[model samples]
Target: MKALLMLLPLTLASCMAGPDAATRAATAPQADAAVTISSTTLSRQHWQLRDAVDGSNRRLDALLGLPDKPLQLDFSADRISVSNACNRISGSYRIVEGHLVTTQLLQTRMACADPTLTQRDTTITTVLQGGPTLILSSAGHTPLLTLADANGRTLTFAGMPAADAHPGDDGDTAPQQP
Candidate 1:
């Protein structure tokens, strides 16, 4: 019930979404670079954090800037909601100058058990607000979404279509409610 309340705005926004959003994410495996990206395409799956790294390939998942759980991103027509943030994080998003930009970010005031998580909201907020480069591609059968900031840090997500993904399908230790 609580989760539903958090998602209500996203649901409403999606109802107002366009059939498509401006296309383009980033480089892919040669052939898929030209793949089209629409609001519909983006909202098609539940993107889970697969890896977080820097240009040096240093893993940064420990500083996920949220609760100790897999980070999940959901897209509506023009809005994006973040899960595993302890509190809900959402806002309007758009493509500007070939980058994914998030604005008007709002987060619930719910407290988190981990001080590290709570204190790092600024980290994630800063990243999202930085207008990171968006890249979408696929590996075999699964879709991959990547967001890279100017600082060379990246957040890559693995797409899991709602119809094809189960609660524990990809070794989810902490499952977030929708």
Candidate 2:
């Protein structure tokens, strides 16, 4: 029958519609558990840049320049502080729908004469301003943080316990040399 043939396609389409709201709701608890695990992992650590890639997926090592000191990120209950070689940047951040959104970012005004340091700092600020999606995972025994922007650029970081982060209590002064 012609009517039956037409209805057959409609039925098949509905079958391919994927999981409905009820099914998603039923599995939300599991998803929430995973998110909680990830949040705990990230919150307990301080992270440092491992590598960076541009929107074209090209490695940005040349542009980033050689680091004279470790670049770092420290996360607290409400703020993130960044030490990008020569300058310090801080901002408030919140996790929403599994994404880290940074707001009210502030950076030190100290002028750096080194072009390389200035360029690297500018790139870091630009990436942070884009509100990249955060992905936390582990490789071997090391924790990794990957921040991917909407344009496909990614910055990967390796993390250590917050207690081991460099610089002093204020995250501005370098540790005094013996």
Candidate 3:
């Protein structure tokens, strides 16, 4: 009876070891259906912010303010730089399982007189710091990068091809003129 009890625990442990090979194989195709965005794909362009939404509210126009300088996110091999109109934000980012994860953000300490620009800066930093999941897709001929936050806020950007990317620059530099 003692030997049987010991064997029973071992059996239960094995059962709790998670999905077996057969189960994994059955779901392999479904998992593969989620196309992973490669570093090459991400690094191949400069992404310009097209629109931003906070919950159900459209915040792009307000974020852009007067004269309308577009916000830009540039991704290199391991770093991300954001041109948030007035101040620049830089960070390290990684893609895992088709999601972009950002960390170690460093932003310039420039003070803006305009309250709207200040608010926009705060909003951009908040969204980036949230480590939103990126959805990489295409709209017609344009490549799109969508950062979706946990609170349902989303920022969408349009990608300009590597050929059209800024001359004499990679994405590592903070605040390159747009």
Candidate 4:
């Protein structure tokens, strides 16, 4: 009975030391699994911000812009564009090794009269300037784009169908990026 008690503690200690072999294997790609994501994959999709939270997981609805308008992110061949209630923001962007690398964002000079709108611009800049990890998941009906920024904020965006995203578009015309 004493030997069994001693072994129980040892087993628990080993489990607590770190992840088990199975856990490590699950995190890594298997022989047949392909994991590389091409930057162009995002170019065809339109994304709208659905949730924003800081490191503490506090809801930052202020970054959401006005209730009537959505804060949108559009990916182009070599640019990342952000459209909000107040300004049009764009920057050169690249998805390097699963991280979002970008030049400093360039936004229009228009001054927003609304305080929340102004704050939204600043908040978006904060989360995007630092290289963030980009994760795209298509498990749900609508695809999801998650950005985990260096400031520890997680921004979750829901994918919109290109056709649905630009309802007014004639098939021959495409939206221009900032």
Best by TM-score: 4
Q: What TM-scores do the predictions have?
A: 0.66, 0.67, 0.67, 0.72
lDDT (0-100) at residue 54 of candidate 1? 74
Model 4 lDDT, residue 57, Cα: 95
Please list the residue runs of candidate 3 whose C-alpha ends up more than 4 Å from where it truly belongs after superposition.
1-34, 57-60, 66-68, 164-178
C-alpha RMSD for every candidate: 19.9, 8.4, 9.0, 7.3
The sequence of per-residue lDDT tens digits that candidate 3 reaches over residues 1-178 is: 9999989988988887666866878875343344456665677778888878878766756675654567778888799888755578888888875567789688888989977677667777888888788787778767888888888888888988766455334334332334
Could you tell which candidate, 1 or 3, scores higher by lDDT? 3
Evaluation by TM-score, superior candidate among 1 and 3: 3
Ranking by TM-score: 4, 2, 3, 1
Highest-scoring model, lDDT: 4
Segments of candidate 4 deviating more than 4 angstroms: 1-36, 164-178
lDDT of 3 at 135: 81
Q: For candidate 4, write residues 1-178 as lDDT tens digits.
A: 9999989988998888667776887896443234344445566567788888999999887877575677788887689898874788899988887888889899998988888778778877777888888877654466678888977798888877665244223332323443
State residue 158's C-alpha deviation in candidate 4, in Å. Answer: 0.9
lDDT of each: 0.73, 0.70, 0.74, 0.75
Report the lDDT tens digits of candidate 2 across residue range 32-132.
23433234455567787888898898998743566545467778767878876557888888777667788968988889887766766777677777777
Among residues 3 or more apart in sequence or in different chains, the pairs in candidate 4 whose N, CA or C atoms overlap within 3 Å are none
Clashes of each: 1, 0, 0, 0
Off by over 4 Å in 1: 1-33, 63-68, 163-178
